[model samples]
Target: MEINRRDFITKMSAIAALSVLPSSFVAAMGNEKVEKAKPKYPTLKCDVVVVGAGPGGVPAAIAAARQGAKVILLEEDNMPGGAPVDMYVPFICGGPRVGVFQEMIQVLNAKHTIGGRTCETFGKTGSDGKNHWWMPGSYAEVIYQLLEKEENITLMCAAPVVGVKVKTSGNRNQVTGVRIMRNGDYQDIDAAVTIDATGNGLIADMAGCEYMFGSEAKSDYNEPVGIEVADGKVQPCTWMLISERIKRNAILPIDKLKGSSAVEDNLNRWVKADDKEDMIRRDAGIYLHWGRTVYCKDTRDPLLLAQAQQEALERLQENLEIWHEAGYAVHLAPKLGVREVRRIKGEYVLTANDLIAGTMHDDVIAHAHYSFDVWGMKIPEEMKHIGPYGIPYRSILPTKTEGLLTAGRIISATRIAHSSLRVQPICSNIGMAAGTAAAMSALNQTGLRSIDIKQLQDRLASMGLFDGLKKK
Candidate 1:
């Protein structure tokens, strides 16, 4: 007799619960101690394998599952929700309502508000908008529940993809399978299609696809803005800390706290400074400017990342104690808010010119309404506040790699353009398209480039997305 997935999960959970029982409890039951057996691992196969499970990968997994494809969502963290929930980003950024962004607003009960305060104009007109403030941990639960409803989707947390198996066909290479590390055991996942929503293009790198890192030369795309040569000084990562006001309590001064001397000095200076941003208020007793910007050569480097995390925690601890004395409860997020990283070299590379001119392409799959909001880079004043532009399907397609597609911040775009499209809503849109494309490719036994673009657009339209892509 065959068992269903639900039954398997229930039995596994029961075994897990029993394994953790106290020795005394087992002895009380008069059961003899038995030697434990080694864990059994099995090879898994799926129609689609999506890595990252962040804002982008979550939707990708759901979209593929909705298409009746078996999907494996691999995440490095214990849960989904990506930067918005993990890093405690207060609200989703303003964008056109379509696709997952529209669905998420309805499902998550998101309210259109500014700075957590109600605004009739912005809410009614629905121009520039942000969701009402929410805790990341709570929002993570919402994302988890959403994924759980998809019977075809299997979400594995803390299971990182260690390798991508690739095979060369004549001149180009194709991904065959992937190796995953889960609980000191290696598991192989063979998929018909792979989606690289890893934010930093980790799978693409493992597949040996051509990719770009940091900023590109202004001459390369030529719309003006950004560094002249490729460099690692793309954007500074931020650590967001949350705080709430309460009754006053006894606490020590900020100097005695175990914080970086430089951070402590900055706090001391801010105390006496009169020209601080509105993010800090004396009456509020809680500061939102607690998030710190840190410059690191490589955000992926374990040593550098650890240092950044340590610095963030120290700053958080120092502020929490200071705020505690002033009647506030402050806490820091466990994840770092990374902005920019690796971008796959796709069939078409969207540039700042495309964004500035609001260019529409023949293969437009989605649209973005944002500017080149690059931080830590020298962006020209004229390059600011660009209007809506269409994102091409070719931009998400790898140039020489087959059987794979990349979305989210890893999509093909110029450095200036990435800063605009790297937000949650836009990334979700890209993920939806990628997932659909992957599903179609898997079902038809075709490569990504061979998928019927018009048919894919029609499917998206039926699902109430891809309004920007008009059928010819």
Candidate 2:
């Protein structure tokens, strides 16, 4: 009996879903709802595919490759280094001391691009001590070279992932591949496992995974740092700029400026940069204090983006003029420093309590040591502690999505918990864990949830990471 094209396609999709879905999902499919049409596109197959070649995506690709998987890394930008190159956020926090973090510090030191510890505002060293800093150019270049050294990793730039190919079986949805735009055409790339290191939860959102944006109420997660009401309001994003000191004589007189008297009034107050201790501490000419912030929730709105950018530019222009008198010219940041965005709901949602307690989990794969640093938001009492939190393997696992895991700032965490984990070093560590887990899942022909947590932890330990978990 000949079947109709629609029927045939439906049957084929079921077969594909059955081939890849976990046992639990397959068992639940008997009573599952309607079957949907499978996507059709030009295809490429790989062991694993990672989206967004930022700080997280880069390390993720490298980790999967080092695990002997054929990996493809997709980036929307022409180059990698999403934050450093695109966002111009040159700060690398003291998060992880091991694994890729150590390698990065060593590389920066060897290249002489590592700036010694810097003090708060005006470049003055704080009594609390200084933290390491590096030029974005050097950091991006080193990351590129590192990716190049990995034979198993294929880096694709200017390829933005637009959609996800999900095969739903029973209660679970498995991401078979991602639909990406390439050379003005859409194409499908299949993978056994896909890592969402986009840092904005873009892949997870497209995959129909459960996620939350902004803030959650304290009662929701029993979070001390949560707000009284869940309003999704998060810390604002900053537009950072680079500057260089020039001779003071290069500055034009305030009377020669073209602006309202109100603008001039503010400029007069802000231009006193010569002896202000608030302005003189850093060796790098980059000004951290001179930033205009817009909420992350409003970041994607075109009108909001335009308005925020204009405000940021106007503020930057004023700072430039002020610095011009103090001998500094400005270089604007390429992208805004977005502090928070979509927090994908994962198998385990880490909370502020866990971070403050430095809770250890048996399945821990990575570690983050950073203070709960929230910009433009009240720091709750629970977030005030200095912590070395153990990030478990479950933190990156999407709650209902099979064949997918998260890395970077997009991992499963409460808004307050994320404030600490979103730093560069911690994100890189999470990337390595996600990549390693993806490789294992692909090689074992198992869904990401089926991979043995202990085995994954063991692999990380062998890689000279996850040692912190031993103490617990």
Candidate 3:
């Protein structure tokens, strides 16, 4: 502690040396740098290229592959399951009958994750008595694997598609392929047909399709209550968690992070508030009830992220301690729940009215659920859950994107309707439609508009999407 000029000079010299050496080179100086290793093989390609590895993209990729087309499923993360494996989103709906979706369930009954496909919950009865469903999780990975291992399908993990280029045909536009972003490099994927299952509608939007966002005000698309308009108020995104193999079977008890103001105390709390009219019923593991929740502020804009990170950690720990005292060993979830962001507007804009009215389309291809959920612009500090809705094949087929089709939350729907139809079962149904539709589109080499609806319907019926509620 009493070292003087000699030691100080040596210490300053070391510091100066480190400051001059490039960061990575400094590590190499002390055998700390990790040498980059090259892959044994080169890049791969496919006929169909799908971006995003979310629940929606998984099945769409599979459907495309099963259709005898070479396919590539690209996921940004190294792993595949989107919300379940990454965001810990629970619940999968949209199924009212028997099909591969159901069969996939029967196969995954043992593991918490179906066949290691990300999923949650045991079987739950539905308002539609005919359906018994579980919220699928890593199950998407199972689905991804099943598709990728097929002779025709390939998977590109850790690749994110950031750019899109569209080619035009006679009055119809086609997506020739996508340019995937991998760090500083761009990966080009060329294909005849592209499925825009990027969850937030990146592909479809880039393809020059029309789109909208946020819930409509009560005066717009008339619901059971009134017409709702979607402005920029998006649903709150979930920093979700999905932890498993717990020591106790009880759910992690987290209500009010210890010293935070209670719901009653926060009469005008800016941190956590929601629409008073929104339904807050508990569905899946998430507390669907409306009221107070954590609202992490942009409290550290002038400071370092480390400080903000510490504050957030403190809040979480404070909440966790309360549960631990109550005899529940709470596990931090592996992923966060992603509620919303970026849905591509396609040839059609699906409105809540379209779902509520159950608009029959000559191009009808897929069906959805009853929940019309919205995430923002309410008085309560909670998400507004409406009932489910249905999706039509026409919604996926871009009016202009001839060689492309959209699926899942990005389909042509109003913000309110997208909220309704964006759940898992509905997303899977869209996948079903995409596969069949892709096949149809490929075989005839026609625009999606030219596909015979009668033929599509017949194909769906044959594939058991329209089969009995239970597999025969």
Alpha-carbon RMSD of each model: 12.2, 8.5, 14.3
Q: Residue by residue across 331-362, what tens digits does model 1's lDDT show?
A: 66777777876788899998888988889798
Residue 35 displacement in candidate 2 (angstroms):
17
lDDT over C-alpha atoms for residue 186 of model 3: 54
lDDT per residue (tens digit) for residues 1-472 in model 3: 0101242233335644555322111111121111122223344445667777666777777776677777887887877767555644434544443444555555444333311222122133122222222234446645654654667667778887655545543334456766665665555666667787867665665555545554456555445432343345455443333222234444423343344322211111212223222212211132211112233222112233234334445555655565556444433434334455455555556675676566755666765545555544332222243323346676787765566787767777656666667776677678778866876676567766778888888878776665433322
Q: Against the true structure, what is each candidate's TM-score?
A: 0.79, 0.80, 0.68
Stronger candidate by TM-score (1 vs 3): 1
lDDT over C-alpha atoms for residue 401 of model 1: 75
TM-score leader = 2
Provide the lowest-lDDT 10-residue window in model 1: 22-31
Off by over 4 Å in 2: 1-42, 118-130, 246-290, 300-303, 324-327, 380-383, 467-472
**Selected candidate, larger lDDT, 2 vs 3:** 2
What candidate 1 gets wrong by more than 4 Å, as runs, is 1-40, 110-130, 246-290, 312-320, 467-472
What's the lDDT for residue 147 in model 1? 80
Residue-level lDDT of model 2, residues 1-472, one tens digit each, is 1112243235436665667543211101121321222324467899999999887898888888998999999999888888877777765664554566557656765663433444332121111223444556776787788888999998899988866767766556788877777776666788999898987887776666677777778888887675788776767777765554455434323233233121111111223233334223223333333355655445435466667677767755665566566565656667777777778888898988899788878888887778888776678565476577788888899886788999999988888888889888789888989999999999889878788988888888887676532332
